[model samples]
Structures are given as C-alpha cells and as structure tokens.
Target: MPSAPTPALPQTTCKSLDDWNEPTHARRIYGNTWYVGTCGISVVLIATPQGHVLIDSAPEKASVAVRQNILSLGVRLVDIKTILLTHEHHDHMGGLASMQEATGAKVLSRANVVDVLKSGKNDRRDPQFNELAGFDPIVNVHAFEDSSAIKIGSTQIQHIPMSGHAPGGSGWTWQECEKGVCKNLVFADSLGSISDDSYRYSAPDSLANALRESSQRVAKTACDILITGHGTASDLLARLDGAKPLLEPQACVNYAQAGALRLEDRLKKEAVK
Candidate 1:
C-alpha cells in the first residue's frame, strides 16, 4: 500500500495552561488510588505503608494545585517516595521536575523517554513539537522496559508500553486492596490519534500501527478499574462519586476498541485527501 505523504507540521495556536487548570478536588477513586489532578488532566496517587507513588504531574503551572490536592488528602509531600509518568507530554510531566525536587522521589519512566525528559525537549517525531513548549528537565531518572514490575511496600506496579502517541507512551497496572477487597486497576495512556492539522497518522513512518498494537495489548490486561490520562475519557468524576461501578471488567477492552476505530476513521479520511 502506498503511504500518504507526511503533512507539514502546523503551528497551532497555543492555549494557556491556566485554561486547563480548573481545580478538581482530589478524592479516592478506589482503594489506595487517589485522583489528584485538575478537571482536564489526570494525576493519580497510590499510597503504601512506606510512602506514596504519584502518577503524572499535570502541567508545570498547575503543579501547585496538584501539591495542595495531595496535602488536602493528609499526605505529606516528603512521603512521596516515587514519581511515575504516563508519557513525556508536557501536560502529563511538566510538573515532574519540581515535584521530584520537593519530595526527593525517584522518577521512573520508559527508557525511550529518558532523553526527552532530561532535555526537556519534545521528540522531533511528535506531531505537536512546534506547538508545545518544553518543560523543566529531570535528572537521574530510572528507566524500565515493557512489562517491568516495580514494587514498593506491598504495591506492585507493572509498566506497559503503549507507544505511538509518543515514543515512550506507557501505562501502569497495579492491584489495590481495601478492606480485604482487591481490584486490578490500569492507568492507560492517551489512546486518541491527536495531532496538529498538519500531521497525518497515515504517513509512511507514522506511529499508527504501534499505537493500535499497544492499545490492543492494554485491552487484554485484567482491568477491574480503568483510568486514562484524560479524566473525561474514563468518567473519573462520576466514578469517584460512587455513581459508577468500580468493577468494569470490560472497560479496558472497550476503550482500546473505541480508540482503534477512531484511528481507523482518521486514516480513511487522510487516504481520500
């Protein structure tokens, strides 16, 4: 099949991070997992006996809120033992450097993302590199590979690579137990094929295929509760309110399938153009 021509990168209008910083109260989504991010982005906290593990740092400007949200939950910033990332996107990791410095927590992410994180630069392959601003650089990050398990106290987090949206796009799966009831939770990465109008998923060297494959892999995980990088994608607010069931055995699969469909549709549109 002939690949579509790679479109020129566009200079999309950049929106203020403030616009995305609508304060969202932190709450326990389930077991030890807490939602500490803003209304638009998602930052999760998993507490253990030793300390806490934080996932995704939101944007830099919004990090103060993230910190306050954690404090509001009665957790001390110094007790945050580890910081994990979903990917190297600014929205997800912009606050990491500051958070790491404040808490002195070890940072972990996929090996592929180390350079980008350290350099505070977007990968040239990213569609929105021109539009997105670089974040503060992080140093001495511990890198892991696919299916690697990290154990802290009694909590074990499995790292799953879900590349395409970014080279190091990843997910984390862990079992949380509360009152003798345990649930397998998966914090899946952003699955949407989002890009500037100048980018094409159908391009010859596009990450489309890897994205689809990773999405499918995430779907196969045993997920009792599913959350994503974006709060709306998983109905995080509703779920936290107890209006939604905690055990959604099919949530992971369904989310992956829907993302695949959206990507397929996007490719079709590009073919016609």
Candidate 2:
C-alpha cells in the first residue's frame, strides 16, 4: 500500500459529546466510538477490546477529515483493524484507499462488487470516476455471497444480500461493540430505487412490483436500527407502528415508496380504461 505524502490529520482540539455543539463531521455515541458522516454517507467506528471495525470509509477527500474526527473521540488510526464496505459505490467506498494506506488496515467487501469496481476502471470511454479518486481502499478484498457470515475479533458480521442499487449490494450486523454492547444491523445502501423525499419517480409497474417484494423480504427481519448507505441512521423502534416490524431492511422502504408510485399509475390507467 502507498502512503499519501501529506499527513492525514492535523493538530486539533479534542472532540467529544460535550463539543457536539460544535460543527464536526462526527458524533460521539454511548460506546467508546464515533459516527462520522461524509457527503451523504456515514460510518460507524467501534472501539472494541480486540481492535476497531469501521463500517465504511468515506471518499478520499473526506478520509483525512474522518480520521481527524475519529481521533477527536480518542481513537488512533493504527488501532483500526478492519474497514468494511457496504457496497462499492464511490460515496461509500471512496476514502478506502487513503485510510488503508495510512493505517495498513484490511479492507472487506462483497466479491461481486470487486468485479464491478474493476469493470468501471477498465472502461476507457467512461472510466469509473471512483477509481480516479486515487483512494482505492480495496486492493485486497474478501468476497462473499448472500447471507455469508464473517468475523473480526469479537464481532460476528452477517452480510445480507441486497440487489438493484448494485449487483453485490449487502449489509452487516455487528454482534458486539465495545463492552458487550450489541448494535443494530447495519444495512449498506440496500436502497435499490426511489430517491429520498426530494422528487417523485416514474418507474414502470413491473419494476415497482419487484421493489415491493424486495422490501417485504427486508422488513421481515427484526433489528433496532436501520443504517442507510446514504448516511442516515433511523431507529426502527421509533419509526414502527404496532403492526409494522421495527428496523425493517432498506428494501422495505425503497419498495414501498416505489409501490405507492406505481399504484397511482395503475389507478390512473384504470380511470382512463
């Protein structure tokens, strides 16, 4: 791994929950860890007794800043043992190259995604913009199919298969955090279609039906937290109605939204017919 010439972190004031009032890219949680946000992405850094497990590394530009933010919470780069990629999207896996070089940490993501990442790089006409970022945090990767389980120290991670957003889309469930604290299932960018509440989509009916099924499968699981690949963490317990499952998979919401849109289209067609 090559090292970035410039230092990743500069001298900065200690950052913590007391300093939450201050504008920072990270926020301290209950455990001895921090949640750092990058662009529309966010990652969880766990300070386990064994070492550290970072959910996802941000873009190369944000890697140094993220490192500084984490150190502010009392963790060092050398302590990071593993970097996990939810998928191979640039926003989610962007800063991996820089972080790996600086910390010499192992990178992990789905095997199928590596193929996509490689294909993007080889396309001469339209090279994958992600590789050009100079943050290839994934030189070495551990590929797994759907529902595969992996371990990092005391952490037991189960990678759930999610498709549409990317071929090898997946999520992780952390069995234990520092001090035996069990965190919720971390779904990496499981959202297949339908953007956030900014605009309506015009997807075909067949696509909408498929999305609904995807959501149904995802929402069936029981978890406390829903971590979106785009940096939003939703507490499923609070969002759930008595009838709905809490911490449903990302597919649940993505499909529901698309289904609603498709339903409207069907009703309109019926009216015309």
Candidate 3:
C-alpha cells in the first residue's frame, strides 16, 4: 500500500506566478527547520545568520515571484551571498544571471556545469543549455573541486560532491537547526530522482556507478531529513530496508534504464496484443 502524504504548510510568497503556485505542501520536519520547498520543483532558500543561500533558481518566469518572496521576508536581495546551481538546466539555473546582477551573489556549480555553460560543448543540444551558455560569461562562477564548508549564521552547510546531476553536482548538510536541537542533511541530488531534463541527454553508464556509490555514502550519514531534486524529503532512513537509495546522477541512469526495460516489455506485450 502507498504511504499517506504529509500535510503541507500554508504557502506565502511575495509575488505570484500564474504558471506555478507557492509551495503549500512544505513540511517543518525539525524545529526552526522547515522544508520551504515543494515536491518535484522548487528553488530552496536557506536562511542562515551569515546570509541566505539559494539551492537553485526557478524558471525565467518564476524569478520575479521568488524575488518578491525574499523581499517580503524583509531580506535584501544583496544579503544573498550564494546561489548554488544544482544543475545546468534552465529550470534550475534560469534566473541565475538576473539574480547575480540584482544581488551580486556569487555562483557556485560543478566544473562541468561551468564548462557547459561557458563552452556549450556537451552533446545535448537542448535550448536550456544554450540559454545557460549565454549566461555563463555574465555570471561570476566559482568552481569547487570537492566538498567544502559554508557557514551562514547558526547553520553550517557541508557541500559534498555527488556528481551525475552535473559534473559538479553537490548536496548540503545543515549541522544544527536554529533552535539548536535538530540536525539535517540536504542530500541535494545525491539520493533523489533525476530532474525531467535528464531525458535530453544520453546519460553515460558511469553515472550509475557514481549514484550507487553516493547513495551508500549518504545512507551512512547522520541526516534525518534528505532533500532531493524532485519528490519530498523522504524518511528514507526510516525505510531503508524497503527503499533503494541512489545518488542524483545514478538515479537518473537507473530511471532511464527502468524506462528502457519497461518499453521492451511493452513492445513484447503489444506485439501479442
């Protein structure tokens, strides 16, 4: 039987986007720590004492809505010190350049994402990448080879490299909540489903191995909350026995593999039909 869904909190945004609604289903898992994000789509903003850090940017059209929400909170756009790119896809990096121009926030992404955005050399010819390619030169991008620590007020984030989503895909771990009680890890993409855009590229086989390895590592972490790219912050640890956790990129490859297998079976059944 399927598990019941968690009730979402009341959504409040500064600006409205007719295309997408504010995330009304966000849950406050730990005290002073809420998943101010939506299932399957969102640009998660973490408020720390040091400054604000955005996980990803929403689509081009939704940027205004996001900016309004931040301003509504009485937070200046300039206070946002970092805009982390989860991937190079337009949905994830859509308002990157604009946000940077408006707030002077530094952009951090995997080297591959930077390369693709700068060079447009990837095999996939999706228009989103092209759009990102155009923004590459305008934005100030800083590349991190592996894991790094970012301190924001009371929150301490550990940025871990879990490539596959992007050559430099990463997840973040919040050491302790503001209330000083709960500790959570934002798996970012390490233990989550692939974004819809992964369909554009023929995901390499090595990506699966990377995800499997990353999942195993994530499974061993002390995180109580796992924020994925899509879907909800699952109690994955609570149901590890029945669940199969794969990293962000590995999960993409697995998802593609599963689709291929399903298609083959469908073809067999349809031939008989």
Candidate 4:
C-alpha cells in the first residue's frame, strides 16, 4: 500500500504546539500495537495485512510528527483503514480532520459525538462544555455502538462506554499476540473528573453519575495490558521505554480506583463551594 507522504502543516504562530507536543520517539508497544504520539498525549497504531487501525490523533500541530512517526515505522498513511476517537477533546482529535483526509480512512465515533465532530464545536453536554476549544471540523464520520466489534484483517477492536470525563468518551480493547503469547490490550479513555468551574460531579449532574458507574465497570474489567489516553496515566512511556513493567494484572483496577477517588474529592469540594 504505497501512499504519498502527509503534507506539511504550516508553522502556526501560537505557542500551544510547543507546550503540548513534546517531540517523542515512537515505538512498538506489543506485537502489532505501537505508541506513536507526543509525550503529553497518546496515539496508537495496530497493523494488519488488510490495513491498519489508528486510535486517537495528536493536537493539530503534533499531527505532522505523528504522521512522520508512522512513516518511520514503515506504515503507509493509506494503510490506516479505520480511525477511532476516545473522546471529542481537542488534544485527542485535533488532527483528525486532516488525518482523515491524509489517510482516506473511515472515521468511526460514538453516535452522540457525530455532530460535534462535523461542526467542530464543543459538546454542550460535556463537563467542560463551553470551556473547550473547538478543533477543525471532521467530515464523513460513521457511528458505531459499544457492542460492535470492528474487524480489519486479523485485528478486532471493541468499544467500552466511559462517558464521564467528557461526552462521547470511551475505552477500547483488542488482543495483541507476541511470540505465541497473547495479551488483551486496553486503550482506556480519560477518566479524570475534569470540568469547567461551573460543573460539578455530584449526583444531580447526569454526566457525573455516568462516570461513577463507568469507573465501577472499568475497575471490574480484566486485561493483560493497559494503555491510557494520556501516556502519564499508565506510565505508558516508562513501560514502553523499559523503566517499568507493562503487564500488571491489576492495572485497570488501580486506574479506576484512582479516578473514582479524584471524582469523589472533586464532589466534596463542590459541596463545600
């Protein structure tokens, strides 16, 4: 699958790219999975004979580096067949519009976020809501349900609803095999109870309640390897760089607990406020 290189993005005058997109080397996580994003964010690649699957994209400025890294790993942009987003956050999908154009891949997202993606507007239902900065509008998006198992060649990706940190947030899971041993890799979505000053995670807020349930469900789910949307969340870079072990049986459990605690703490503060 030979394809032309992704076109260069003109250098923007803004300082955001320099701050958010710390240049980081890309590397294989396990088997066919690869970590190919900036230091502050996470972009994943799963390759197969039919094509490849890309999970998340960097901020707009970081997209160039991401595409370069993909090429460095010998993956053609056109080989990326399916593009999935963990949420509607700009840091996660700012590059998606251009990425979709570059790769000519089908963009799949939760049905609820289709409008936000197409319009390049903040999702009013999101905790951050009006505080969010819009990204470039994406086009030709297809909706997929949580129960749908998206298959491309030998790879199968499943979605797990985790709409609390933000609307349309989700976790993804897939199996990766290495040297006769296979590990269930989970790309857990952001679980931080972040919000604008006006928002609260208390029971009255429907989104907050959803997060509570999501954390409980995620805590119970078992997986061999966990890769969070933020590299720092699971110490992704450390694990990939050999500073820490990658396979921890209780990773998801611990992650969920930590997120739940954060949400609880936020709620307590909101009560006081």
Q: Pick the candidate with the highest TM-score.
A: 4
List model 1 lDDT by residue over 126-173, tens digit each: 866667789999986888877789899777999888887877888999
Query: Per-residue lDDT of 96-156 in model 4, one digit per residue for the tens?
Result: 9989999999899899889899999985688888688899999889998864788887678
Query: Candidate 4 has what TM-score?
Result: 0.91
TM-score of each: 0.90, 0.64, 0.63, 0.91
Looking at model 3, the pairs that clash are 8-25, 49-153, 50-152, 50-153, 110-168, 190-247
Query: Please, what are the lDDT tens digits per residue for candidate 3 over residues 1-273?
Result: 011123332344324222333433333334433333322345566766677777776555556766765654556788788877666655556566677778898877666567665542443433233333333343577776566776666566677666554455566667544346555545455333243333422334435445445555455455555555444334332222234442232433343344344434533554574
Which residue segments of model 2 deviate by more than 4 Å?
Answer: 1-23, 29-33, 118-137, 175-183, 194-214, 232-273
Cα lDDT of model 2 by residue, 83-193, tens digit? 777656556676777777777777666665665554433221111222333334256555566677767565676766654444445666554343785546545444444
Each prediction's whole-model lDDT (CA): 0.82, 0.53, 0.52, 0.83
> Candidate order by TM-score, highest to lowest?
4, 1, 2, 3
RMSD of each: 10.5, 8.8, 8.9, 4.7
Candidate 3: stretches off by over 4 Å: 1-40, 119-138, 190-205, 232-273
Q: What is candidate 2's CA lDDT for residue 242?
A: 29
Which window of ten consecutive residues has the lowest lDDT sum in model 4? 9-18
